[model samples]
Target: MSEVLVAFLTGLTTGGLSCLAVQGGLLASSLAQQIEQDVAMQPRPKGAPKIGLRSGLRPRPQIAGPILLFLGAKLVAYTLLGLLLGLLGSMITLTAPLRAALLILIGIFMVGNALRMFNIHPIFRYFSIAPPTFLRRYIRRTANREATWFSPLFLGALTVLIPCGVTQAMMAVAIGTGDALQGAAILFAFTLGASPVFFLVAYLTTQIGARLEAVFMRLVAAVVLILGLVSVDSGLALVGMPSASGMLRQSGSAGQVVDVPVTPQSGTLILNATNSGYSPTLLHAPAGEQLTLNVVTLDTYSCARAFVIPSLAVEQLLPSTGQVAIIIPAQEPGTVMRFTCSMGMYTGQIVFDL
Candidate 1:
């Protein structure tokens, strides 16, 4: 799979997981209990409701199976899309406004989700559909239709229609990628990611209501949320869509960067911003060859000029102030040589032929 596809798929999958953690766990707990009681005459637990981690985690098996299924399916889906398509036929030019917009949007999403963790808005309350009392009360509780899993599948397909803030942010990401088919695939993966827990809950009735479920729930939420906000690195990876690490090494081209000796490369690059920005900003190198970059920034913030190269999928902040040193050795060819500063004010590109 292309690196771009991998990152997008990972992001979409995790985003869905996060959505489920938020909703499948506590978000729907109250409703789940209500639904449980509406059918069964089982009196509410005497003193404290037994809520913990693992037990609560059991509710979304339908989601997990499908999520795992979706991951594989998404790969195949993208393959199908890829087979009918040519190599990506678009420009990879990162601009400042776009980066700032994405960051601000994400930050806003984080802050908004952060706020929602505290309390839901009145407008949101309008759409917060818990099972109605009578729906809960008289729905043939014990004999509830397990065969209707087609329901979540039905709902999951259109899950985007539900107004969730984080999902909106993801929608923006899909749109930004600028591929309709890929976006739909991303959404499908996301739905599967979120549905796992809910379906699991429906499948294993007692497990969800088991004791010690609270701790597991908290852990799941924390882990998934942390994963969802892949930080600026993810943002960079999304924009760069780097095919291989060879793109980071020095090249033999003019007006480009070249590094040697493969010594310790600087961590964060700071470049002074300027107008009429630089091009071929991202530089890559093949294995065992020293690489370097010759950068000149224009028309943007110092941070924007800063070149970032994400390795192992971790975001690496580059210098935004002035020209700096970069080294990448090539071990493979016929892959993306390098992607310059993405998620910044300006961007440059370089393709190593060796």
Candidate 2:
């Protein structure tokens, strides 16, 4: 539950900039169309001039009504799409290796998009998914006709097909969930989280006649680039490498892998799960002894909560603030055990070198 909340908040903060890049223009156009219609419908006093672009902009709080409808439509559409994706995900069970590969691929795509934002090389063209020309034309036509309800709703629905890289990343997670309810929840929460920013932008532009500044746009681009780097870091973690943030820095100047800390334990081996990752990523245990692995989590909402030990076929979802224990069968000497998160993003190892 807490993990879901984290996902929603993640969308909220990141969507302010990331979603704006993808859906800002369409929303702005819809607002403009709505404002024009509102002004046209107003009865002008005798000898009064028509409202021009620079004319007195009256605040129309009613604009929020249609914008809310638009957001609601988008939330429904994305949630339904997520359900279908989740159903498909269940059909094709994703193994750790495959999931890791997908994360890395998506990460690369995000990085490329970030680079393109700064006029860097377009590295991953195939990942770009643009809505067809017909869809764009339809949206424009609806706006021109001043179909207030339909235009915003339809445009919002269409945005599902033309999402930004951050959205694509979340979609990949949705597919990985493999549960209809979970998938729908994730996407619905994400869309809901993004609504505030979109609504605010529309309100300011249409009702307040505020123009988007170039400086603000540059800041958004910088944020997108940072998100891209974070995505890449997550991908690296899934692939069993060091995080790009240097949380798991390489040991030597040659960039050699750091020695995973190994602790010898008997009976129950207790481990703490932190926000960065599992403490003591490496462990040493006595073989041929009945052992229990106890994971203590305190308010953890990151991917690490979904624990997995692929080699042992053990998968467990830890609570946000509690302890979960796994009974480990006696293992043979010299056995190396690997444990990871659901996506293989956070990993730890247990060595039985007796």
Candidate 3:
């Protein structure tokens, strides 16, 4: 699947994952309980709610504290999830059925989450419980439910479960990796990339959450929609994209074939890209064996070239940047291998040395 598509899907999963981590179905219930407690503890106001000073500017600021807490907690959850996925991606092998199941679960979550952009959750509506049972039901110690750091942290965690479309796509990608550690790394990076907005929003939930909530929902939807498309790309790939992969493998730049004389063994190849922004990338290695690519880019200003091999029918994306040694399976011999930019523009190949 395309990296862009995968990024979108990963973003969605991160959203839902965040949601689940933070709330776990307790969002609405907890907020309602908090409302009850607040009302119960305070003396009733004598007159109608005055329009001026008490109401203040926008109500988002009031909720900021809770929002941050909610978002932060969720981010923590996803971070942990990422770590777990990375670790797992490195370990166990997955069966086809398991991969497919994970894909479907992820897809449903992403699509559902994207649809939520249009969804009007009762949680967003103003509903409060009576004060009588407040003490027994409230969860947080915040005096008011209007805004708080915890709210965002909770939402951030629970957001991951929202069933966003892109998350589904990402899940498929993670599953395809065949190794638990790699899958986890893919998810971890994806979630990390997508969490900043929620973190910021959590900090500002008080003065802006009401207005921004809708925007956030829309953004989440957009992310999921993109991810859903990527999921379709990958899911379809498992069935067969031999034709497309073939097309990608068909051509390379017209540079003379010198067969660069670095004799790395049949199972391994170390590529030291001589120029800035370019690395000798490969594709198609046997899926089960350990494979290594040693990359070094000359320029510090421009990040070095990263690599990817799309046709293994596996779930992880090969790195396109950063100087690090990651362990991945060698592509199956004869599998179409095509190298591309970190941005997914096809560059060249290693055509598996079967």
Candidate 4:
């Protein structure tokens, strides 16, 4: 459906870019480890005494297998987590205070993690629930010494524990979906979107010995910090605080209105809905005329599917791909009507001028 497609596309583009800072280093490190292991296991030439340790190292192990397993595991984990979050959301209505507290806590955790990544100080490391020394040793042994087929899969699964502000943000939105399927779909799409970068970076490291670790890590630190601030603001907005994000505002726009040339005979206007957002978000219409708002949606599988017009008490759910017409009563001049998605994340409006 459109929702899943849109989610996938979003993940492919913006989500993938955001993930570079979060998972880029981890993917590179894992791939490098696998390559080193593969090189050490290269066959020794006949009658050739090993000149040195790991002499005549074989080429790095084909990353295709490990990368596939890693991404697949992440996809499954994210989808499952999303389903669980959605179920929990359906069971309890989160009060504003509770939601804000949760968001703020998540934001603080992200900020602290970012600082830790930057090695700002040793103290920030203590803020997280890190495994004990013994547990870390066990993990390292499993990954390095054993070198079982499960190593890449295990590492991918472990990514769920690593702090990622974008993932957390998506998790919050998934909770609003109120259904397991929708939640899973959203996360699956996001993970899929991020997979491309994971594969690309991993390939570069293994294929060409790319040395971007330092640069990418710094970029990740900056992104995590920004995401932390955004998370905190979103939480504040939940508690009746004015939202700093312009996407959620309900107030009328003062900008010049788009003059939509409606059909003179039928007073009809056609609007297209895409993944990025609604085309022509603001429209100007003539007053005192019956109007048909024909919204043409093609594979729209996003929050925008839940259309709303607060002033007219209009709430409509759009199909994944189709045309839906809503009757708009003749309005008095100077009237402005606003419509948004169910979460109020995406907005549009109609202005009637005499």
Candidate 5:
């Protein structure tokens, strides 16, 4: 439940604008058709009273029906895709290394896409995802038809083929769940959260001029860049590599190490996972001794509950408020083991002293 809520919030904040930048064209096209029809249906007289200060009276097109149908179809399509991805994930175990690689690759793509939005380089233009030329021609031809309802519904479903960067990130998360119902629920919650934003922005873009749309796209680009960097950092942490935060911490400490007391025989170390991050970002213990690591969470409802130790291949979803014990094998002197949340948002490490 907590995970789903997080996903929903993510969509509401970032996913909505990012998706609008990618998928708004189709919606604009559909709306253009509706406006033209409405204009043709309502002919203005030469001496008709002016509706606004500048122009004669024009019919206000009914757009609510089309927008609702489009969003409904989009929600259903993504939910089904999530279900399929989860089912496939259950069949094939995604190892920690593979998941990390996927995150890194997706992060790279997002970064490239953002650069393209800023017109950084010609090569970055290739990063844009769009329907093939042939498919686009078909869509354009079909959109010109008289069946207004068919165009919006078809285009809405077609958006699944070209998901935005944020949507793609969510899809990866859905696949990671490895459960059909959970995956479906996650996508459903996220899409539902994004619906209102998508609707309002897309609608306004069609009614307003292109200047405002350009400003909105710039804002979206900035957001995509930030998310891209964060995803890359998370992937680095998952692979036990020193991420940006880790590097900063290391520099701040100036090579100093804090020793944590542990029994010569089997020992126990307590670590707290909080909503913000892990407590005691680093720990030191004696080498060549078995250790029991107790991860405690109290009312933590974030990704921190999904504890992971990439070196040991340990992945456990801790309860909202409870403790989970992880047995660590004795290690040689100077061994360093890194641990992080599943999303790699929160991280810590334990170093064994000589």
Candidate 6:
């Protein structure tokens, strides 16, 4: 539930604006004829000042029908995409290394996308994904044919081919779920959350001018850059590498050692998983002793429930409220094992002491 909510909020904020920047052209083209017709149908009273482009007067089109149809098709398309991604994920076992690699790759793409938005380098423009030339020509031809009910629907579904950076990030998350229903739910929630912003911006850009759109794109670029960095950090953490946050923590706690907790039962350590994060992020235990690590979760619905120990190739989806025991073999002195949520958003470590 918490995971779904987070996805929803992400869509409402970053996803909406980012998607608009990429796909707004399609929407505007789809409604071009309709907007013209609406403007034509408006009555001009005699002796009234002439309304022109410079006059800042235009008809507000009745666009609810077309917009809803477009959004509905888009929602369905992305949900099916999520289902397919989840099925693919379930078919193949994604090990920690593979998942880490995927995360890093997606992160790089997102960062490149932000750079492209900023026009930092001409090479960064390659980060923009587009349909094949033939397909693009065909879609444009079809969109220009007429303002029919099918135009918006077709364009909306086609958006799947040219997803924005944030949408791609969410798609990566859907694939990580490894469950079709859950993946579908996540995408569905996200798309629904994004609809309002998409609609409002589309309406405003058509009715008003491009100035607002420019400002929104700049904001989207910043958000995309931040998300990209976070994704890279998460991927690094997943592989037990030194990440930005981890480095900061290490620097802050330099020369300060965390004492090994005395276990209630010898050779067993207990850790709690909550909605926020893992408790006792640092732990220590005697080396050369076989150990049982018990993970307890009570009403936890966040990503923390998807527990992972990357070095051990261990991945477990914990129940909302339960205890799961993981057996660890005897380790050499000075051995350090790191654990994190599947997305690497939450993390902890256990150090084996002599």
> Cα-based RMSD of the predictions, in order?
13.7, 7.0, 10.4, 8.4, 5.4, 5.3
Mind giving the per-residue lDDT tens digits that candidate 3 earns over 229-299? 44443333333333233234344422434243233365555554432323343433444356664454443
Which sequence of candidate numbers ranks them by lDDT, best first? Answer: 5, 6, 2, 4, 3, 1
Model 1: CA > 4 A from native: 1-13, 21-38, 41-155, 162-211, 232-354
Question: Candidate 4, which segments miss by more than 4 Å at Cα?
Answer: 17-65, 83-102, 113-132, 161-163, 172-182, 201-212, 247-254, 257-354
The superposed Cα distance between candidate 3 and the true structure at residue 28, in angstroms, equals: 6.0
Candidate 3's clash total is 91
The count of residue-pair clashes in candidate 5 stands at: 0
Worst 10 residues of 4 by lDDT: 49-58
| lDDT by residue (tens digit), candidate 2, 49-161 | 65664455453536887777778878888899778777776676555556566556655655555555555555534334554578667766866775567777876777777
Worst 10 residues of 6 by lDDT: 49-58
Badly placed stretches (over 4 Å) of model 3 are: 1-61, 79-90, 95-101, 119-193, 200-220, 241-354
Top-TM-score candidate index: 5
lDDT of 5 at 112: 78
TM-score of each candidate structure, all chains considered together = 0.39, 0.65, 0.43, 0.57, 0.78, 0.77
- TM-score of candidate 1 relative to the true fold: 0.39
Q: Report the Cα lDDT for residue 6, model 6.
A: 76
C-alpha lDDT of all candidate models, in order: 0.39, 0.65, 0.43, 0.65, 0.75, 0.75
User: Could you tell which candidate, 1 or 3, scores higher by lDDT?
Assistant: 3
Per-residue lDDT for 22 in model 6?
Answer: 63
Error of 6 at 150 (Å): 4.3
Worst 10 residues of 5 by lDDT: 50-59
Residues 1-354, candidate 6: write the lDDT tens digits.
Answer: 666787798789867766765665566555655665676788878876655432445566777777777788889999999888777766756566776776677678778877887778899878776556675566566655744566678778888876765576577678778888888888888888889888876665545544555565567678778877877888888898766765555455556654456384677888889987777677888788889999999999877888988888889889889999999888889998888887767777888874
| Residue-level lDDT for 304 in candidate 5 | 81
lDDT of 3 at 47: 75
